[model samples]
Target: MDIAILSVSLNVHSTKRIVEEGQKAGHYVELIDHTKCSVKLGEGKPQIYLGEENVTDEFDAIIPRIGAKVTKHGAAIVKQFEMNNVFSTARSLGIMRARNKIRTLQIMARKGIPIPETLFSINPHNIGEQIELLGGPPVIIKLQEGTHGSGVILAESKKSAKSIIDTFYKMDTSILLQKYIEEANGEDIRIIVVGNKVVASMKRISDLDDFRSNVHRGAETEAIKPTAKEQFIALNATKYLGLGVAGVDIMRSKKGPVLIEVNASPGLQGIEGATGVNVAQQIIQFVEKNGHRSRK
Candidate 1:
């Protein structure tokens, strides 16, 4: 089978790993830089161009490693592939929804998945009320599209929370407020799901001075086996999001395990290193099964 890994660069760790694993499994794999891809419409059937080459039907499957900054255009390329009947690890709509925090949370909430108390508002006038709605300060202020904990801020007091939120709103930046789970102790769970199976999971502990537990934020990781409830939430979150591959993040709050985020293109380095799992190979096998089935 021929595979396309839709990513910005082949130098990225995840992209390299996927390519290596695909070749090891006897599949022809290549990187299609989504940033360099264009969609042509009208005239006849719609076509996608990678530079000057028409890539409308070049592969059996696509594994999107779409970056946060290029999600809009990246999803468009993936959508074009989908319309041409190509199998993708993540659907275009799912990629779009997962790129935005509020959209993912809304879908999760509606699907009865456990999540933290989250609120989103664009009204600058009701800033104070919005914070109060989440039980006041010490809340988390996060950019709707921020990744790797870049725009996630923890306000320890009502005054700071209100000030930070007001600044973001004044700048017309999209943001959301969530009830901070202090009991989590700067830790969270990342469960990697391939197809319908939970392939790997790990606990990320934050740096002593930081509250965000993302590995890119210098968090330490260790292997973990999630409980039945955690596994249920992770699996269902992936399913409802229309993802064949996902990374579901959950925090242990005083009440229970509440989901924090869902990653459509989950990184393999951290989870793979922590759990010693051949996650990249699992992804290739998943593609082998579904890609062939889709062709049939």
Candidate 2:
């Protein structure tokens, strides 16, 4: 099979691993930097290009490892591939939905998936009311498109929450507020789903001084077997978002397990290393099944 890993660079650990595994699986895999890709429309058939090279029909499948910074362009490129009948691990719409916390949460809420109590608003006039909606502070504030725990904030007091939320509203930055689950204790679950099944899962423990349990935030990880409920949520979340591969993040609250977010372009490094699961290979195999069917 001819596969393309749509990413910024082959130097990224996850990107490199996928390329190696795809090659080992006897497939011709290439790294197509979506940043350099463009599309031409209204010429009868849409055409996609990589710099000077036309890539309209270059591959049978694409595994997009899109970054938060280039999500729009990357999803556009992936959309072009979809329009051209190429199989992709993530659909274009799914990429966009997963990029924003509000959008993802909306879908999850509509689908009856358990998620943290979340609220979003743009009105700065009622900052206190907004915080009150989530039952006041110790609230979780998150930038809509934050990645790797970069824009998540914990406001431990009403004053701090009001100030932070007002600042975001005044600046026109998109953010969401959620009731912090103190029981989680800075720990969360990451379940890697490929083709309707959970291939691997891990528990991420945040550093003592931090509340975010992201691997990039220097968190510790250990392989974990997700409970049946957690597995159900992860699989359904991926399906609802139209993604063949994803990382579903969950936190065990006092009530039960609630989803925090779903990542369309989930990184393979931490999950793979912690679980000793060849998640890259699972991705390749998923593509192999669906990529062939798409061709048919």
Candidate 3:
């Protein structure tokens, strides 16, 4: 089997692991950097070129390793692959939807999936009332399209929340403010959902004085199987979001486990290391299964 991966940093740990796993499974892998790739739609045909080479070549399947920031170009590259009737670990639309937190949450809520009381208002004038609607001070402000906990801001005071939200709006940044779960203690569970099951779960704990618990934000992780309810939420959230592979963030609160966000391209380092699970193998298995069907 020959596989191609579209990613920004080919040397990243996750991309490296996927390549290694595919090779271990006796598959040839090519890690293509989408940022450096060019696309052309003319001359009665469409083609994607990677550094002067027409990559319209055939392959067993594709594994998209897109980051939240490079979603546009990455999905476009994956879309070209799909047009050639190639299977992907995740669909382009799923990758785009998972990149945007606000849209994903709206879809989840509509699907009857339980999430934290969330508020998203584009009108900066409604910031005060939106905060009140979501409960009060201490709300989680998240940029609509950011990853790795880089765009999350926890506002504790009403005045501070309003000011920060206004600034974000002034800058034309899309964001959502939700009821902050104090009982969560700046910790959350990352449930890796592959296909239809939760492959592994990890408890992401924040560093001292930090509100975000992402490993990128100096968080620690440990292997822990989530409860039956947590597992249900994890699975349903993925299904609701139409994600093939994802990292579903769940916040444990007094009410119950409420979903925070669904990550389409979840990192493998922390989750795989914490659980001691060969997640890349599972992903390859899933891809091969689908590839088999496509071949049929």
Candidate 4:
């Protein structure tokens, strides 16, 4: 099978792992920097170009490892491939949907999937009322498209919450407020799903001074088995998002496990190291099964 890993660089850890694993499985794999890709339309069929090379039907499938910074352009490249009857592990729409926290939560809420109490409003006139809507302070403020725990903030008091939210609103930044789960104790779960199966899961514990449990935030990790409910949520969340591969982040609140977010291009390093699972190989195998079929 021929496969293309749509990413910014081949040096990235996740991209390298996928490449190694794909080669080990005897599949022809190549890395295409989606940021450098361009699409030309209105000249008969759409043409996808990688610099000087035209790449319309170059592969049987694509595994998009799209970065947050270039999500819009990356998704467009994937969309072009999808239009040309090439199978992709993630749909372009799913990438866009998972790029924003508010969008993901909205879809989950509508699908009967459990998520934390989240609120988003562009109105700065009622900042206090918005905070009150989530039962007052000690809330979580997050940039809609933030990654690696960089744009997450914890406001421990009503005054601080109001000030922070107001500042973001005034700056014209997109953000969301969520009820913080103190009982979580700086810990969260990341479940990796591929092709309707839960391949690996890990518990991330934050540094003493931080509340975010992202591995990029210097958090410690350990492999763990997800609860039946957690697994159910992970699989269904991936399905609802229309992604064949994803990482579902869940937090335990007073009301059981509530989803925090779903990652369309989940990293393989932390989860593989924590669980000792060959996640990259799993992704390749998933493509083999579906990429062989006619494109839908």
Write the residue-wise lDDT of candidate 4 on 1-296 in tens digits: 88999988888999999999999999889999999999999969999999989988788999999999999999999999999999999999999999988999999999999999999999999999999999998999999999999899999999999999999999999999999999999999999999989999999999999999999989999999999999999999999989999999999888999999999999988999999999999999999989963422
Could you tell me which 10 consecutive residues in candidate 2 have the lowest summed lDDT?
287-296
Candidate RMSDs in order:
1.4, 1.4, 1.8, 1.6
lDDT (10s digit) by residue, model 1, range 41-137: 9999899999999888778899999999999999999999999888999999999998899999999999999999999999988888998999887
**Structural similarity to truth (TM-score) of each candidate:** 0.98, 0.98, 0.95, 0.98
lDDT values for all models: 0.93, 0.93, 0.87, 0.94
Task: Tell me how far the alpha carbon of residue 111 in candidate 3 is from the true structure, in angstroms, after superposition.
Answer: 0.7
Which has the better lDDT: candidate 1, or candidate 4?
A: 4
Backbone clash pairs for candidate 2 read none
Model 4, stretches more than 4 Å misplaced? Answer: 293-296
Shift in Å, residue 266, candidate 3: 0.9
Model 3 C-alpha lDDT versus the unseen true structure: 0.87
Which 10-residue window in model 3 sums to the lowest lDDT? 287-296
Q: Per-residue lDDT tens digits of candidate 3, residues 1-296?
A: 77887777767999889889999999888888888888899895688888898877647688888876678988898888888788888888888888889888888889877889988888977788899998899888988887898888889999999999999999998888889899999899999999998899999999988989999878999999899989998898787766788999999999999888888888899988899999989999888877733332
Model 1: ten consecutive residues of lowest lDDT = 287-296
lDDT (C-alpha) at residue 105 in model 3: 85
lDDT of 3 at 168: 93
Per residue, candidate 2 scores C-alpha lDDT tens digits across 1-296 of 88999988989999999999999999999999999998999968899999999988779999999999999999999999998999999999999999989999999999999999999889988889888888878999999999999899999999999999899988999999999999999999999999989999999999999999999999999999999999999999999988899999999999999999999988889999999999999999999889953442
